[model samples]
Target: MAIEIYGIKNCDTMKKARAWLDAAGIEYRLHDYKVEGADPDRLKQWAGVVGWEKLLNRAGTTFRKLPEDDRAVADADGAIALMVAHPSLIKRPVVEYDGGVLVGFSGDKWDEMLR
Candidate 1:
């Protein structure tokens, strides 16, 4: 299966995810948003699969630091706009496998889905 992992390179959770992938011997291409910048089209595709609620990292420092008005994202378009403006608002380690997409890091869930 072709897998692509997206996130900031230095993010702790991202590091764990990368380690887990390596331990599992899963070969994947990294799309580090810190350098590559998150693609709006890909973000929308992921949102379509997982929903914007799951894709948006509201608990992250970047989202929390946003002004009250900016944080009031109410729909997919709004959330997408916010995420495009601030890639850090995206949940870390979004994985796109051939069949589907996975958001966030859950070792058990990834093992179940990818293996």
Candidate 2:
């Protein structure tokens, strides 16, 4: 199975997820958005599968720090633009695995999907 995890290297959640994968002995690749940046096409694709609402990290500091107008995005395009411009605006550790994509880190969910 092809599993790619995307997140910033220094993010706390990213660290937890990486540690979990390490303990589980799951082989995967880390797409550190902070260093590598995000692909607009890929962001759009994730938005399609999970809906832009789920992909957007409204809880994160990056999104919270955005201008009020930017935060009031009423459509996927608006959210996508923000996320593409600032990858941190997207949720942490988006895992693309087993023909599907998942955003955020949850041990149960990761095990369910990967195992």
Candidate 3:
């Protein structure tokens, strides 16, 4: 299966996801959005699948630091713009495998999806 993992390298969740993939002998590409920068088009695509609310990390420091107006309301377009400008506002470790997209990892979920 073709798998691509997108997230910042320093995030604890991303670290654990990477370790899980490695130990499972899964070959995947890691797209570090912090380094490569998030593409607005790609963010929109993900939003379509999971919805912007699920894709945006409201609990993160980046989101908390945004101006009240910026965080007041976010649709797909608005969320994509914000994520493009500040990738840290995105939820951690979005994994795209074959025809599936997984956001946020759980041990059981990873085992079921990758095993």
Number of backbone-clashing residue pairs for each candidate, in the order shown: 0, 0, 0
Candidate 2 residue spans exceeding 4 A from truth: none
Q: What lDDT tens digits, residue by residue, belong to model 3 across residues 11-105?
A: 99999999999999999999999799998988888888888898899999998999999998647888888889999988988999877788997
In candidate 2 the C-alpha lDDT for residue 26 amounts to 93
Measured on C-alpha atoms, candidate 1 has an lDDT of 0.92
> How much is 70 displaced in model 3, in angstroms?
0.7
Pick out the ten consecutive residues of candidate 3 with the lowest summed lDDT.
Answer: 72-81
Q: What ranking of all candidate models by lDDT puts the best one first? A: 1, 2, 3
Residue runs of model 1 more than 4 Å from their true location after superposition? none
Q: Ten residues in a row with the worst lDDT in model 2?
A: 57-66
Among residues 3 or more apart in sequence or in different chains, the pairs in candidate 3 whose N, CA or C atoms overlap within 3 Å are: none
For all predicted structures, in order, the TM-scores are 0.97, 0.96, 0.95
TM-score: model 3 vs. ground truth: 0.95
Please list the residue runs of candidate 3 whose C-alpha ends up more than 4 Å from where it truly belongs after superposition. none
Candidate 1 has a TM-score of 0.97
Candidate 2 per-residue lDDT over residues 1-115, each given as its tens digit: 8889998999999999999999999988999987899998999999999999999989978888989999999898888899889999889989999889988999999888887
For every candidate in turn, the CA RMSD to the true structure comes to 0.7, 0.9, 0.9
